[model samples]
Each structure stands twice: as structure tokens, then as C-alpha cells.
Target chain A: MEYLIIIISAVFVNNVVLSQFLGICPFLGVSKKVSTAFGMSLALVLVMGLATLVTYLIQNYVLINTWFGEKMDITFMQTIVFILVIAALVQMVEIILKKINPTLYQALGIFLPLITTNCAVLGASILVVTKEFSAKGVESHMMNLGESVVYSMSLAIGFGIAIILFAGMREQLELSNVPKALKGTPIALITAGLLALAFMGFQGIV
Target chain B: MSKFKYLIDGIVKNNPTFVLVLGMCPTLATTTSAVNGMGMGLATMAVLLCSNMVISLLAPVIPNKVRIPCYIVVIAAFVTVVQLVMQAYTPGLYETLGIFIPLIVVNCIVLGRAEAFANKHSVLESALDGLGIGIGFTLALTCIGLVREVLGNLSAFENKFSSSDGMLVFVLAPGAFLVLGYLMVLFNKLKDRKKKA
Candidate 1:
């Protein structure tokens, strides 16, 4: 039940894109078409989940620990380390995906390379380690590794849903006669504002 | 001089926030208030300027295959430095910005400028580009922040516009989107008219 609540809260109450504003780049960039958004979201779901887990381990077991088995808090290195992990992870995923599933890889196209720089992946990983969680009026310092991974997965799902929906809206929007000034990105951003308002309805769910 | 043009271009022509539309994450997330927006922009500028200069200097040495990773590392280092300084000196802004601070490491504008301008240009030119773009980003955020703060909270900077409640939504997440959307439209309209004239 707790895990389910975590997922629900992540996906609805505190959505990664609309509510939190984590990954607005891809949210605005690749969301022109539903098919492209779907592929990008799938890649995000995979990369965010794996990258968070890997970063969590590195944070707990490696960055914070010394070779002498003494625990030293070198947590400041997290920004650099997490980014490096994400960059390397994206590379590995790209190669493996291309070899195993050429069709999916082709669909992903330029987006796969662009994922390396997506703030959502890096933001989710850093947030998992750094964010403090409070349960039942008890202020827990930070999320445990398992909780972190689950949070990343659910956040990615939320991101996927938001982008896919936005893409659908943009597809229809392309046909509508928008004002000249508000044609491309401006109109899309306004649509996002409405979408965010819609997501606000979920605030009461959790 | 052409160097002067780089500076002017960043402010008006290729403005990072309004024109190029890079770094949307921080542009939206941290512009809840005038102060927060300025703080985030300056921090980003510091990182951008240093990384661009460094990347330009090292471009010849770094292998093409490894350039992106190298650029990221350098950019991340500068972000960390900015993060620490902000935490120590501006604790209020630091606490408020929170995760967005570290997220700056992934900000596309920093890396985008590095790859596009810094790698190919001289160190002096890259530094100028970073400064110009950074200022442009700062100006854009401050403008957005001013609008949101005044409309949402009836406050601009530290001063209150009125005693009564404002639209409240202007300070919220949705407000950021709404304000930025209109601003983009307005900017584009002006640019279009200018081009026609």
C-alpha cells in the first residue's frame, strides 16, 4: 500500500514534468508528434529507472565511502558523478538497443543521443538521493535505495503520460488556426499551462 | 568589433531564453520571484562563462569521440562550485532553488553554447559568448520573474504592489507557463514586426 501510494503520488500529485518542471526541454521539443513522444518517453522510462538505481548505489557505496572502509561524505562530487553515470548509461543503452532492437532504435533516432543531456534523467537521480521523505509525521532524512528506484520509475511514467498527452494536443493544434504571434512554441506553452491546471486536480488524490 | 557583436547578439538576436529557447528547465522552475530568477541566472552565467572558456582552450586536446563527456564534466564542476557558493552565501535562495541548482549541470544552454560556439572559437571569443548569453538569460529571467511576482503576489522584488491578494496562480507552477507563453508570443510578434520594417 505504501509503495502504491508512492507511485500514485509521483505519477499524479507531484508529477515530474507538469507540476515539478523537471524535463521541460523534451517536453517542449519532441512533443510535436505522438509517435515521437511515445518513443522518447519509453527511452526516458528505461534510462531514468536504471540511471537512478546506478546513481543511488554510487552515492551510497562509492562516492561516500573511502577505500579504507571509512565513510567520508564526499557528496559534493554528486553532480559530476551522476552526470558521468548518466552519460555513460545512455551510451551503453544506445549500443545495446541498436544491436538487439533495430526498429525501436531507429524510432528513437536523434532523441537517444539527446537523452544524455536531459535534465529529467539527471534531476531524478540527484533528487532521489537528496530529497528528504517524511512518513506518518516522521521526518525521514532521505529515501532508501529501493524507494528511490521506485520513485524514479513512477516519475518517468508521469513524464511519459504528460508528454504523450501534450503531443496529442499539439497534433490537433497544428490544424487549428492559432494567432500568428502565438503560433509555434508560445501556443504549445499555453496548452501546457492548461495541462498543468488539469494535473492540479490530482493534488487531492494523495 | 565582431566581439562586440557577439555580446549584442546574445542580448537581443540569439537571446538564450527568449530567442534560442534553450534551458527551459531553470527558466521556468526558478523564476517564481524576481530574486530567485536573478540568482539562478547569475549562477548559470558563472558556470557557462567558465566552461566555455575552458572548453575552447581544451578543444584541440580533447578527442572528438570524448568531447561531449569532457564538456559535461567541466560544466558540472562549475555548477558544483556555484552550488556551494550559493549555499554558503545565499542560503535562502539556495534552499528555495534546491534541486534545480544541481540540475543546472544538465542545462542545455551551457552545453549547447560549448559545443556550438566554444569548441570552434578562440578562448576570448568563447568567454565573450558565454558572458553575452549569460546576461541575456539573466535579463530574460528577471523580466519573467518581475511579471510573475507583480501579478501573482503583488510584489516586485521586495516591494508589495498592493495589500489585497493578487491572482495567486501567477506565482504557482502554472503561472510560470502562462506568463512565459505570452511573453514568447509578444517577443515573437515584436521580432516579426521588426523584420518586416
Candidate 2:
């Protein structure tokens, strides 16, 4: 039940893109078409989930663990270490995917490189370590490894849904006449505001 | 080109927010108030200045194929430094900016300048470029934050004029998008007018 609430809240009520604004770059850059949006969404889910899991282990074990009879706390290195890890992980994923599965690699190849700079992946990873999660009527506590993975994957799915839906809107928008000054990105941003307004209605749910 | 031109170009012609549209995440996320927006922009500027100078200095030694990662490491180091300093000096602002201070590592503006201008230019020119772009970004963010704060919270730089509450939505998620969209149109019109003149 708690996990379900987390998923609902993440996907609708507190969407990563619409509400939090973590991945606005890709949310705007890649949402021109539904097919492309779908591709980016899949890539995000894979990377966000994997990155969160790895960062969680590192944060718990290496950064804040006891070492040689002394409590070690170098959590400040969290930013540098996680970024390098995510970058290396993305590269490794690209290579391994090419060797093992050619077609999947072809589909996600371009976006994989782009994912390294996508703040949503890094933001979600950091959130897992820093932010505490609580469901409705439940006491808030730090998320364990299992919950963090679920939360990160759900956040990616939420991002996917928002971007895909926005792409559909943009597809139709391309046909309509828009003011000259607000032709491309400006109009898209307004449309996203409307979408975000609609999503805000779900705030009462969780 | 003159060194000063690089700075002016970043502020006007190549303004990161209004023109290049880089670093949208921080522009939208942290600009709930004027002070918050300016804070985020200045923090980003500090990182950009340091990373640009350092990267330009190291461009010769870093392998071409691995320059991106090298840049990321340099950026991450400075971001860490900024994060620590902000935490110590301005804990309130630090609390508000939260994950964004670290996420500056991925901000396209910093990395974009490094790849585009810094590596190709002398250290002094790159630093000037960083300052120009940083000022441009800072100005843009402060503008957005001022608009949002006034319209949403009925305040400017945390000074409340009408305490009864403004639109209320402007401080929320949807308002950021709406305000930025409309501002983009306004900026384009101004730019077009300048071009015609």
C-alpha cells in the first residue's frame, strides 16, 4: 500500500518533470514526437533506476560508514562521486548493450549519451539519499534500498507519461497557427503550464 | 575579437536563458522568489567562472576523446566547493536551493561554454566569457524571479507590498512555466525590434 501510494504520488501528484522541474531540458528537448518521447522515457527509466541503486549502495557503504574504528563521513563527496559513477555507468551500459543486443542499442544509443547530463537521473539519485518519503497517514522514514529503487523507477515513469502526453499536444500544436513571437518553445512552455495545472489537481490524492 | 566583446556577447546576443535557452531546470525550479533566483544564478556563475578558467588551462593536456568527462570532473569539484561554502555561509539559501547546487554539474550552460568557447580560447578570454554568460544568466533569473515573486507572493525580494496574497499560482509549479513562456515572447519581440533598428 505504501509503495502504491509512492507510485501514485510520484507519477501524478508530484511529477518529477511537471512539479519538481528536474529534467526540463530533456522534457522540452525530446518531447517533439511521441515516438521519440517514448524512447527517451525508456532510457530514463533504465538509467534512473540503475543509477539510484548504485548511488544508494555507495552512499550507505562508502560515504557514511565506519572505517578503522572511526566513523567516516565524507558525504560531501557525494556530488562528485555519483556523477562520475553515473557517467561511467552510462558508458559501460552503451558498450555492453552494443555487444549483447544490437537493435536495442540502436534505438537507445543516442539518448544514452544524453542521459549523462540529464539532471533528473542525478536528482533522483541524490533525493534517495537526502529526502525522506512518507505516505498518507503513515509516519515518514528514510527509504530503504527497495523503496528507493521503486521510487526512482516510478519517478521516471511519471516523467515518461508527462513528456509523452506533451508530445501528443505538440503534434497537434504544430498544425495550429501560433503567434510569431511564441512560435516554438514559448508556446510549448505555455501548453506545459496548462498540463501542469491539470496535474496539480491530483495534489489532493496522496 | 576583443576580450570585452566576449563578455558583452554572453550578456546580450548569447544570453543563456532568453537566447540559448540553456539551464532551464534551475531557471524554473529555483526562481520562486527574486532572491532565490538570483542566489541560484550567482551560484551557477561562480562554478562557471572557475570551471571555464581551469578547463581552458588544462585543454592542452586533456585527451580530445575524454574532454567531456574531464570537464564534468572539473565542474563537479567546483560545484562541491560551492555547495560546501553555501552550506556554511548561507544555510538558508543553501536549504532552499537544495539538490540544484550539485546538479549544476549537468547544467548545459557551464558544460556548453566549456566545450564551445573555453577550450578554443585563451584562459583570460574564457574567464571573460564565463563572466558575461554568468551575468546574463543571473540577470535573466533575477528578472523571472522578480516577476514570479511579485505576481505570486505579492512581494519583491521578500519585501511584501500587498500581504493579502497575489495570484497564489505564480509561486507554484504551473506559474513558472506560464511566466517563462510569456517572458520568452516578450524577449523575442524586443530582440526583433532591436534588429529592425
Candidate 3:
């Protein structure tokens, strides 16, 4: 039940995109078409889950662990290493994707490059690092491997939902006659504001 | 004569946050109050200026193929320096800025100017452009911060501590998204009216 609450709360109340503003570049950039958006979301879900699992081990066993049975703290090196790992992972996926389905690769091309620098990608890894669970008012300052993967998957789901919704709205907006200046990002932003307001309703669920 | 336009462009006509919408992560995340915005802005400005200066100095020597990576290294170096100093002295502010601080290394505004303006321009020009754009970014963020703080918290620039309870949304995660989204709309409307008149 607790885990279910964690997942649900993350998806709606603490949405990674709408609420936390982690992945706006891709959120606003690739969200024009629902089909492409779904692909990106699926990619995100997988990456977030896998990346969190690996990064968590890296942090606890590598970055925080030292050779010769000693403990080392190179926490500051996180920024560089995380980006490097994420860049490599994204590239590997790109290569596999290109060989498997060139069209899918083309569809994901823009978003893949965009995700390399996405704060949300790094944000998920960092959140699990920083997240401290409080159970029954007692703070558990540590995250086990299971919890890390769970949180990352939950955050990715939240991102996917937000993107699909935004893409749907943008699709409809394409047909609706609108003002000239507010045709593109302006109207899209206003639409986001209303959606954000609706998302705010989820705050009460927790 | 044409040189003056460069200075004017960054402030109003091509304001980084509102008009161009270049770097929204730091703009929205760090601007819970005027104070946080100012601090983050200054930190970003310092890094931008140094990185621009370094890139301009290296522009003549750095090969075209390797320039982007070189610029990333330069920006990341300065960012690391900022990260270390902040972690040591201002741990609290460091925590408040959170991931947004490290994300600065990837901020399009910094790298954008470095690649577009800094590498092509002279050292002095690069520095000045950094100053102009940095100030523009700061002003835009401060505006958002002021509004978010005032409306969300009711206590302007009260990140430190005070007797009153602020609205808290301005500081919370969602508040950043909502604030920037609406502010963009309002800014667009104003620009539209100005163009009409």
C-alpha cells in the first residue's frame, strides 16, 4: 500500500514535468505530436528505471566507496560522471534503435539528443539520491536499491502522462483557429498553465 | 552605430527568459524569491563572464571540430569552482539552488552565447555581451521571483526566516512551472499590444 501511494503520488501530485519542471526542453519541444511523444515517454521510462538502478549502485558502491576496504567521498564528481553516463547510454540506445528501426530512430532523433542534457534525466538520479522517506513521521535517510528504481519509474510515468496530455492538447490546438501572435509557444504555454492548474487538484490526494 | 543594438537587444527586445525563453530551468527553479533569484543570477553571471572570457581567448586557437567540447570544459570548470565554493561557504543556499546549479553547465544561455557570440567576437565584446545577457536574465528571473514570492508566499525575499507564513507555492516545485507559464503568456500579450500601437 505504501509503495502504491508512492507511485500514485509521484505520477499526479508530484509530477516530474508539470510540477517539478525537470524536462521542459523535451516536454515542450517533442510534445507537438502524440505518436512521437509516446515513444519518447517509453524511452524515458526505460532509461529512468535503468539509469537509477545503475547510478544508485555507482553512488553507494563506487563514488561513495573506496578501494582497499576504505570509504571515499567524491560526491562533487557526480555532475560530470552523471552527464557522461547518460550521454553514453543515450548514444547506445540511439545506435540500437537506428539498426532496429530506422524510422523509429528518425522519430526519436530530435528527442534523444535533447534528452542528453535534460535536467529531468539527471533530476531523477539526484532525487533518489536526495529523497529521504518518512514513514509514520520517522525519517528513513537511506534509499535501498528497490526504492530508487521505484521512484525513478514513478517519475518517468509522471513525465510520460504529462507529455501525452500536452501533445493531445497541442494536436487539437493545431485545428482551432487562434490569434496570430499566440499561435505557437504562447498559446501552448497558456494551455500548459490551465493543465498545471488542473494538476494542482492532485495535491489534495496525498 | 550598429554596435549599440547588441547591448539593447539583450535587455528588452530579446530578453532571455520572457522573449527568447532560452533557459527556463534555472529561471523557474531558483526564483522562489527576489533574493534567491538575485543570488542565482549573480552566480550564473560570474560563471558566464568567466566562461565567455575564456572561450573568447581560446577562439583563435581552438579547432572548429573540438570547440564545442572545449567550451563545455571551460564552462564546466567554472561551474565546478562555483560548486565547490558554494558547498563550502553557503551550504544552505547551495541546497536551495539544488540540481539547477549543476544544470548551469548545460544552460543553453551560457553555451549559446559562448558558441554564437563569444567565439566570434573580441574578448571585450564577449565580456560585454555576457554582461548584457546576464543582466537581462537576472532581471527577467527577478521579475518572476518577485511575483511568485509576493503572490505565493506573501513575504517577499523571505527565504531566510521571518515571522509570517508565506504562500509557499512560489518556493515549491509546481509554483515554478505555473509562474513561468503564465508570465510567458502575459509577456507575449504585452509584446503583441506594443507591436500594434
Can you give the DockQ of every candidate in the order shown? Answer: 0.89, 0.93, 0.44
Evaluate residue A121 in candidate 3 and report its C-alpha lDDT on the 0 to 100 scale: 81
List candidate 1 segments past 4 Å from native.
Answer: A135-141
Q: What is the lDDT of residue A133 in candidate 2?
A: 91
Candidate 2, residues B141-168: lDDT per residue as tens digits? 9999999999998988998998596998
DockQ of candidate 2 against the true complex: 0.93
Which structure is stronger by DockQ: 1 or 3?
A: 1
C-alpha lDDT values of all predictions: 0.90, 0.95, 0.79
Q: Report lDDT (Cα) of residue A149, candidate 1.
A: 89
Worst 10 residues of 1 chain B by lDDT: B2-11
lDDT of 2: 0.95
Compared with the true structure, what per-residue lDDT tens digits does model 1 show for residues B1-197?
A: 97888888888889998889999999999999999999999999999999999999999999998888899999999999999999899999999999999988889899899999999999988999999999999999999999999999999896996899989888888899999999999898888999999
Question: Please, what are the lDDT tens digits per residue for candidate 1 over residues A1-206?
Answer: 76777798889889999889999999999999999899999888888899998999999998878767676889999999889888889889989989999998888756878888789898889888888854443446688888898988999999999999999999999999988999988999999999998998887776
Best by DockQ: 2
How far is A68's C-alpha from truth in model 1 (Å)? 2.5
TM-score-superior candidate, 2 or 3:
2
Ranking by TM-score: 2, 1, 3
Error of 1 at A139 (Å): 6.3
Docking class of 3: acceptable
lDDT of 3: 0.79
